[model samples]
Target: MTNSNHQWKKTALSVVLTASLLGTASMPSAMAASAAPEAAVTTDALKAASVGQASGTIAGTPLLQSYALTDKLQVEIKSLLNETTSEGTRIAAVVRVRSSDANVAKIPDLELRVKTADGYEYPMQASVFNAHAIRPGTTEELNFLVKVDRRSPSELTELVWYAVDWYSYPKKETVQLAVPVKGQEWTGPLSSFANSASSVLPWERSFTLSPALESPLVYTPVSVNRDNTPQGPVTTVKMRVENPSATKEAVPDFTIDGRSNGNGSTDKTVFPGKRVEASPLVLEPKEQRYIHFAIPTDKDTVLTNFNVLTPETFRQLDPKGQPSQVSYNVGRYQVALPVTSRTAEFNAAKPYEPGQPFVFDSLSDTIDPHLSVSMVEFHRHENEGEGYQTVIAKLLLTNNSDLPVPVPTFQTKLITAQGMTYSGNRQTGAIAEIMPQTSYAVSYAFNMPTENEDEQYVLKFTDAKTAAPASTTIGAYRVAMQETKLDVANMSFYPFKVKLNDWTLNARYNVPSALSPNTPISYTYRMKLDMDIARNEHVVVDPNSSKMQLELVDKTGRILSTKSLPFSGVNRLISGPQFIQFDTLRTEEHEYPLDINIYEVITTPTGEAKRLVGVLKQ
Candidate 1:
């Protein structure tokens, strides 16, 4: 025989013998015992032949084929993806390891590398596996990332995996697998792959509560939407989480695989998923709330199947009154993607009109102070020299419950149909207390651009005191300005019953303007009011409130000057003759008929105008 042929035959014989010994080691106890002596002899002969023969590389295994690192541990590469990032080219391999032993399997220190066709091997940059132990009959998924420097060859040819012995340094079992790179290239920015556009299928998952509780917590997906920002694309997932248990239940921590880079690198390669809105740590008993998660991603990513991990841990007192920690594996929920409908119903916001009531059943379990927004008034005014417009919202709140309820503060916002937002500038009104079955009015002044007067506006309210769920929108009302005109014979306002007995107007010359001395001698117009006033017992009127205001207007309904009726206190509205002085007028003003406006001004203890109640135009 030729020397080359002899060497090839000997190498083939050694490989066959080595394979037999490895197979014997994995057999059942009875079969392994029967072949123990023969396997030992074969192992010795194979080792002797391997010493003299040239070291040959192992053949590459196909992707997804299971390979044995030891008799108890099995591993496979489920998927591979390559992405281009600003820092470098990233090759991510999704690896899964399974243990079939009766005892716990100690995972060996693992090393992974990406081998290119040009003989370049890039070492693993990071891994998701942080532990070294795996329970019997359990499986764990790991993400292995290999980073190639910028401009390096990215044509992946093989995946080189090594299992190194923890005790014996530098000794490792290596395996090479052929990579199918045709469709594995991400071909875009790393953010695009991580933030791929995906939707949750219609799904409802239930988790058991504490042992003391009877009902389970229900979780359902409501909607998914993508928004583009200057930083990147944010994909938000809205979920409806409900706790039907009689006892308060803690909110479980939720995590999604692939939502984070998990590269364990210092570089800010990717951002982690975050809860979109502020959430309460615990769900009140029988409380249902909607939560949102904002994840960063791209438009091209498709999420076929993903796992949501929810593990809940809490401390509970034992029967003996000793505290013990209890952990419940809420479980990893596998969600299928690309669904059309949601399983849970998303509550639609009910539109309200001015003066319509938006009733709130309960603010909390113990504080069921049924409150309602009985009336809403929109008043628009232009600042003469400030170059802006002021929109005032007069809200009348009534307490329907028997107990006195303190008025709730709200984070008020005025939104337009064109997506413009104006924050409330100042709030005024009696906010101390609302008597049982009584009504109190408050005003929120929003200063906006003059050009926005024509836009459709909605007043939105969010609770400012309690840390309510973000989805809890107290109310939204359409702001439509209406002019209230009353008959001159019968003049009566809300929260008060009064009669306009008689009135007289007299004009007098007042001091001239300092800046325009030759302009004209201004006429000081005074009107005396005489009437019988009867107060509404169900109204919460502040003691230090101011009197009704009077405005002299032009023919076009533009207010020319304003003055307040002289009154001692709110309780004595009809004490004696009250005069309203409009001191800004010219001699030419007496020729044209002047229109008068009456406004009820509610005030706080410090004399700040709380609200401009009702308007009566004559």
Candidate 2:
């Protein structure tokens, strides 16, 4: 599976694409079009040896304009590569899309960007026509890759694409039939592991086979570390058997397959085993072991060879001794090594100052046996626009384990004391299930570093491996940006005063209403609860804690009517003036629009409990 549907599974920064295949064609009105559909030109003897140019636009419209493809499919853009290598400057492009529609057509969810007149935009790490379901009149071909670093090639230029103005091709009970599997082949000698400070390259590979009577069978390999663990970026490997010889044998347990080295060809089978005892492989004489086979490795996977079957190498490559077994032309041997993330290291270990906590009781089975992370707050906020700056943290997670703990998937970074590692921009809260000893409060808003030099600013929690990180410095000074305005007026009722515990709390608001038709509004409010400082701090005002809301819209703000009001006191002691009245109903010529909201939850003589909000407007 060259990129077996590209296998994306990190789950938080998003970028997953590889799904195309499902056919049935017939809608050719000359390939219909009114505009936005140009970029199929490559004939001047094939565009004079082309090197670039495929035009784009899909929500800015223009590809030539005109748009109508609800299942007669027919998209264009054919070629465009910007190649520059050495470790950067690679941008490939090709978009086909062909269907005729007679009952099979689909291509929803689309996005691709590549602009460059020197404005730089490049987005599309993966997702767009990877072939899994696009079969109607047949003509799939959607590939796009981006790398950029050797200085963006030369300002590159043009190749945009986007879809969803009403996308089409999804009906056969909502389509889902791609069926294309066949990828797992091998030749020999191949073992790659990327390096040069891009870190993560811890490898190990061994071999020795001799089936058919079963005598020799070494095969070592262990390196497991699902990257930052969460089962993402995967790297597995596992398989350590031996038995160099001396009788007592049965063998039989190999199975492993992978493929991807150019032009994507996904063969499947990425670590699926069960022969250590689910039967077979008896070994006992010199018995040496470790099986339960595994192989994973999918984030930019590049195999091209990794087939390792058994049953006496499928009965000595059969020709006559066929005891039967046709698992795909039967497998035998092919394990050239090429799994990626060069092994795996997940760096991060030098820069501790805000209360040290980058711990990981070392994953006691997976994420420290389920929950207990830490890092209780880290501030720094200012300069939120134009150049950027804002940290704000608070990640406490605590589930103590009892089932209901699943919060593994993180990737935060801010480092920089000259080590540089910025990268924190999509953390809109996600825990998906916590409940056990209970405690879940995750709130991070990172975005600081402005091109370096604020000195320390660490704040890294890479993947909270199992919680142990508490502070990352970042407290040099900067947290001034509080704008909370709300003081409306047109006088129907308005008043504001906040000074709790030291006295003074007179809040009033009864405004918001203008566009009558369903009319009948009445409001009365007043409050005075003071024990002068103590009469046992007098308390008595919980008419459901006083809260009122009424809405009746029709000026297009939707909302026919809503009402609320209830104040029930249970007492602690109190003496004063409290009058709350509420009645609503407005309807005159049906102009609608009449809203009012008021809340008051008080109790302060030193008992603390407050909730106030009412800024009248009409």
What ranges in model 2 sit over 4 Å off?
1-259, 262-364, 369-386, 389-393, 399-618
- Tens digit per residue, CA lDDT, model 1, 1-618: 374354334333333344464431122233335445655656665565455332422111112334555567766554455556567765666556778899988976667777766767777644423347789998766655555677653656666655556566666444422222332333332323222222122244332322112235666654454444465665555567677778898665664432333333343343335565454468889888766666665544433333443333334456997756533222133344334332111212345655667654232222234767755456664454566667766667788988888877665667776555666643555457788888876666677787775534666665433322222244555565645445444443444555666677666665568887787645667778776766656566444333566767767767677866534454355635776667665335553466666655543222333223334333
lDDT per residue for candidate 2 within 359-438, as digits (tens), equals 54231233445566555445443342446555545456677777777765564565544444445543334346776776
C-alpha lDDT score of every prediction, in listed order:
0.52, 0.38
Give each model's clash number. Answer: 3, 53
- Give the distance in Å from residue 362's predicted Cα in candidate 2 to where it truly belongs: 16
* RMSD for each of the candidates: 15.0, 30.0
For candidate 1, the lDDT comes to 0.52
Give the best candidate by TM-score: 1
Query: Which RMSD does model 1 reach against the true structure?
Result: 15.0
